[model samples]
Target chain A: MKNRIESKSEVDVSLKDLCKRFGDFTAVSDLTLEVHKGEFLTFLGPSGSGKTTTLRMIGGFETPTAGEVYIQGELANDKPPNKRATRTVFQDLALFPHMAVGGNIEYGLSFQGLNKKERKTKALKALELVDLEGLYERKVATLSGGQKQRVALARALVTEPPILLLDEPLGALDEKLRERMQGELKNLHKRLGITFIAVTHNQEEALTMSDRIAIIDRGRLEQVATARELYESPKSEFVADFIGVANIIRGKIIEDNAGVKKLLSDGLEFFIPSKEGFNIGDNAILVVRPERIEIGDKARKSNNSFSVRVRNIFYKGAYLEYYTVLESSQEIRIRVESKSSSQDTSADYKTTIGWNESDSVVLTREPK
Target chain B: MGRVTVPKRVSLWAFTILALMFIFLPSAYLLLISFEPSELEKVPRNFSDFSLRWYIQLFHQERLPGAIRQSVMVGLLTAGITSFLSLLSGMSYRRLRKKSYFLGLLIFPMFVPGIIAALSLSVFFRLISIRSSMYTVVLGHVLYALPYASIVTLVSFSGLKEGLIEAARDLGASGFRAFKDIIFPLTRGGIFGAALFGFLLSLNEFIRAYFLSGWQETLSIYMFGQMKGGADPSIYALAGLILSVSIFLVLVALIYYSFIRYFSRSFA
Candidate 1:
């Protein structure tokens, strides 16, 4: 029976307690995620982190060992990939090499039994949607790496599937081309407004393009939030470390009053809102972003401050990285704006570095 | 870079000529002897004494034409069956998790000597009370060709990117449709190679045909019978004819492979 797709709903793709195992190896474990309609959701993680596995489950290319994948409110765990209203732009851009650009894009339409003229028009429209108007007859072999990527995208999108799955689509392109394609893809996502679920190891790409980023590690999801939320208030140490440069300070809760806890790490003490299921005298881990810390005169204004010896200064064009070690020998990195340095903050000596207590987060357990 | 010396160029040309001559000499000798009035055990030494006597005798020979037709039929059937089976199994071969051990098992036939396999198969057929014919010979050749065909097909798959078939299915093609549209087109060259390999191997195979081809005479079996007493000069002519065709097939396969490699290189 034909699965006539219903109207768009609030949630386009819903993965519930999904798990996948290949013999003894668990590729995805108890991963539950909900993707809203028309929002670009990215599963961002390191390789072998189950991000791609989750994407494949959504596309129906993989069957979950446990739990369900729902597309448009219908359970799709048993449905074949072709039966699901999803298309994937694979990492290698698996365009049919023997076919022309038009043929590649028109492949799905052919399966739908569209007539020749209709298929051609639809193929052209899809190509144009990806900004490659005309040149329909160009062989895939002749297309540039970026062009092939666009063709793969167009081909996947031609059928107008409500959700588009991408497995590192810009991975094949060089640095400059990859940057350019990132912008193009973001624009395409905006113009199409489909629920695009993309898997990528690139944190920058996820932050730049995704409406929400799900940080996954070791086959389990660490956290799912907007890019800003993920960067500023990561729930787990893995999410903090994976998304950007994070300095995790191992400490203990010295005291607690109401919901606030006083944390004492090696040669440093600070106050952070107490996490649940933890009390005074319990071990506390503090996560601090490198960019959140201030050095020099500004350090005196913050609630949390420490004296640190400057170990190294890395001069980036936009920002400078200060690698410093506290008297406790706790090494931490601090990022400073290159444009705002009125005086040399690069002295190879002791300096005070600090951030507001609210900027740092205290967790009860160490990361796995 | 230093210029190539005259001696080096000459030596290279000389080596190439010698290699070519060494390879083609036996076939050339057979061809010359077939046209000459040569003895049963001797090759014609003088080109001046060459004639078309062997060719005429070859045409008048009994059961030889039937044997040639049988061999051709068996070759085509075996090649088609072998390639189809290999392509079918080769698809699953890619998805195998324990690929190394399974691949070793798949290629087990190539490890055993052909005579041993033939003998075992013939005995097994006898135990099963199955009569041998051209079909039996075809089956024997299929066993022999399967390993080579699968190897060629699996190599083609290695050159392809992972998840292509999955991508095809993800793009709204069914499993069968994915194979038809994506997998088959991508690996057609390898399938063709398998077919050629199967046909050539079956065409020239003797021990298997000798033991298994009951009530039917394949070309090799017919030739072996002729050589039971003392072989005719006409037999050399037939052998020369078969050798020439096999050579032509080898040339065609070489060109086909080179073309595929060249196109793939350019595409990459």
Candidate 2:
């Protein structure tokens, strides 16, 4: 009870030991997190990873089978969606097709005891805030995909909800439009300093638009941190692989000297950063990013360097990727910016590859 | 759209004209005979003999106008009740797990023969000590029209995307408010369409009205009685009037269907 009171005072929303099960299938399990007062937080996961289910639970659309949900420090497990202080922009945009843009935006205002004139005034204001000032009278069907997305945002905003929940809000837009809206959404969050809880499967969108991102996998909270922290220091192999391109090297820690550790795999030796509780003979996983592995003359200066045969090269417009393999048949990918002068102008050449000790992240294998 | 050969286009036009003529020929014959001036002649002897003599006499009959009024009253009541009930059933159909089973049960009455249904309803009302009246006639008509009404309303509800009601609720609208602001307006076209179907079905119904009518006969019953008693020129005039009214209503329904189609998809 004391902890509950403390959480209510500090957190805008709290989920404690929350679990949701559909028959034998557990959609969410014992998940707990706190959303701060005014921050952009994203729940990022793969499809069917329970991110949307968690968002629905927060918005009062789904009741948890066990545990509790608190909004502004008050227990809200029994509250209906309309009684909660959260509004959601659905995945499909679910704008009322029968109503004009103004009518859709003004729908929530009517419930707040605002008269017809006041509702119109507030709806027009919301439309302008979304950069659609003159589209209030326009029919929803006449709007383009991006315009419809803005109308959906304006509709949810007009209610002045403290917590705005977006379920893949830009999932329907084209790629370029999606990126543009991502920027617009970030701006809106800054301008209106309200809690924004968005759910998405797109890792890039989550990284670009969120103050903090919570990584969920198979109904479990894997990690929650800022984008930089999550990318630079992923705690698990799943996080490293899911967030971006990672070259995971699995081996046993065979040597620990000073603050550096030596890992041995397939008769090859690699150096990694050491942490507490990592002793000799314990198996570990190392996550080395592609761009971090330097080739050519720069490889000779690194602590852990190896010779590899270039297998293939892919020109990726912005960067060039070289697929190389070591003598032990282990594959490695190296990303070099397109403007770099590291191009050898030929394939099937032997080249040395290396990364600094600190750049390789070591993950201690969990006990079975 | 591939380009059609000239012969194919001509044949398509010919088939369309033939279908239209097949549908309207009987109504045209009724209109022509109603103006025959000779009481015994079924068709007008000459275009010059066309007159409004039977039409003037048709309205003077004591019971015909009253019968038409009662039939309209019954039709309105049936349409209102069937549409309201169908709305409830249609909305519930969305929430049901076994949708096909529920719909099958709702539409099961369509298979029952009309004479059998009318006789059973009359017997059941008598067993319950209920007298024949317009309300009873409405009850029978609602039973007959509900299957079609529910289908129409269900189709309308299908066009409504999922999560709309939930979105409205998330935005602070209560359950009732969501229905008023979202559900009703989006699907009102279907509801109105269901009501029109019920009105037409009830107006043309003869078997149930014959068994369940009160002191005042319905228009169908009166027309049936007049046909059996004598083949009068005034009866032909009455048939022409009924045909014209039915055609007008059908035209209105067609216009409404096109209007809603345009209104809903103009932006798309």
Candidate 3:
């Protein structure tokens, strides 16, 4: 009987309480995640945060010490890499230097027992998909970094696996090439409609390419949400700190009125509207993004306001960034459009920073 | 405006001439004597009419031809066996680093002096009631060549880029398929070099052949006997032949090295 997982809409790849241990060290711990069909899910975290390990487990390069992995709804914990219907583009792009571009892409087709002519046709088509149609006879070692990356992609895609795993495939390219490849990869995913699980530590890359980003930390799953949800409303201080630059002010919750909570710092108060599960007298942190901290002499009435002395100013071409030290001794950074810095503010004077209560979030302090 | 100092060329020529004299003098002396027309008891104090009579006599001997044939057969067999076994063992060592200690034990016979190893093997064969012959001589030569072959192959295997294997497997190749398609082709240079070395080693081996041979005499053993029995001009002819063969082997090895260098440089 055919497995029902191949026909399901819920998940194409799923991990259940997965854990990997290398002797005394745990590389990944009790991780559970679901990758939906045709979704671009990214594992984003710092190095050694189990993001790569999780990706390897999904690709069948690693076997979890505990828990199960399901690929297309079939149990794949014991399956070898060759047996799985998943292909991985390694971080180094691992293109075979000994083979020509056509040879490398045609390799997997040979294992399928395709004849020479058929294999060549399929490989040419795959290369054409990456816009490298005429370079099939070129040696891989002679290609540029971006071309090598395209060859790697063509090699993996020629197998036509249901799920494609990319472990920082663009990490080796220069910034401009990386950006271009990122767009090309995203477009390829849309055109092919294959499930793509990419692992990267670059937060911007994750935010730009992923349908959902799973932020991991120190071998544990921190949060998995859409890019906007992770950026605008982070559940933990780690997620907020990891996704984007945010100034975290630690304070004690002084009062809770209905759902809004008022937090007291050293000499100031911050009001956050409707923080779930936060009680009065609880030690919490208020996370405010740098872009949200409004700076000007005009005292616009707002819920959270503080007087800060500008310590330094950075004039970027598009935006002006000001680093200020608040009276409470807390440092805050604010950014405004370069054209918005009027001549009056150009005199480099002290300023008042303000934001609405809903602009900030009260995040629980992570365990030490 | 700037100081100019040329490197001293005196010591360079001194070392070059000294090295050439040290390497070529003995071989040249043998070549000169091999062309001398003289009797067994007479040693030429001065130049005499050069002749090829000794070489002709050396080649016309009945036993010498059989001994040469036996030596060539033994060398070929030793090279084939040593090269095949070393390739397998070396590849295993490369793949399984944890098992290197076991491989070291397998090749430990290489550290023993050839004479001692030949002696030990002789005693072992006698205890097992196995008689010594050309087969035993080939076995002894293989023991001496195996370790050298293994070391050469291991160095070549270590130089390979690990990404090639990973890429092969990622492209749906089984372990065996990857080894055959990628690993073996990339290592052909090392294999050929090792085979040449093993052939030379077996061809020139003297002590091991001396102890292991029974009815048949290897070329080296026969040459040793001829040298000790009497000082003949024909002995000089035989010595010249051996030296020429050694030079020919060296030239072959140089050719192999050049091929490998060209292959790697062109592809790299």
TM-score of each: 0.92, 0.91, 0.89
Q: Residue-wise lDDT of candidate 3 within A1-368, one digit each (tens)?
A: 12334454568899999999988999999999999999999999999999999988887778899999998888989876777778899998877656788988998898887899999999999999999989989977678888889999999999898889999989999999889888889999999999999999998899889999999999999999999999899989999998888999898887646655588888687887675687788888999988887876553576678788888888876887788888998999888777754623343467798888788888877656
lDDT of 1 by residue, A306-339 (tens): 8889999888879999999988899999998898
The C-alpha lDDT values of all candidates are 0.85, 0.90, 0.84
Off by over 4 Å in 3: A1-5, A256-260, A298-300, A340-348, B1-5, B8-54, B97-110, B127-130, B233-243, B246-268
* lDDT of candidate 3 at residue A280, scale 0 to 100: 81
* Clash pairs for candidate 3: none
List runs of model 1 lying over 4 Å from the truth. Answer: A5-9, A256-260, A273-278, A340-342, B1-22, B37-50, B257-268
* Candidate 2 C-alpha error for residue B128, in Å: 3.2
Better-scoring candidate (lDDT), 1 or 2: 2
Candidate 3, B126: how far from true, in Å?
A: 3.8
TM-score of 1: 0.92
lDDT of 2 by residue, A1-368 (tens): 11333443657889999999988999999999999989899999999899999999999989999989988888999899988878999999998887899999998888788899999999999999999989988988899999999999999999888889999999999999999999999999999999999999999999999999999998999999999988899988889889899988778988646645678878888887867888889998888899999998899899889999999888888888999998878899999988966755468999899989898898976543
Candidate 3 chain A: 10-residue stretch with minimal lDDT = A1-10
lDDT of 3 at A223: 92
Q: Write the per-residue lDDT of candidate 2 for residues B46-143, one digit (tens) a residue.
A: 88888889999987899988999999999999999999999998789878888999999999999999999999999999999999999999999999
Once all C-alphas are superposed, what RMSD does model 2 give against the true structure? 3.4
For candidate 1, what is the lDDT? 0.85
Error of 3 at A342 (Å): 5.6
Clash tally for model 3: 0
Instruction: State the weakest 10-residue window (summed lDDT) of model 1 chain A.
Output: A1-10
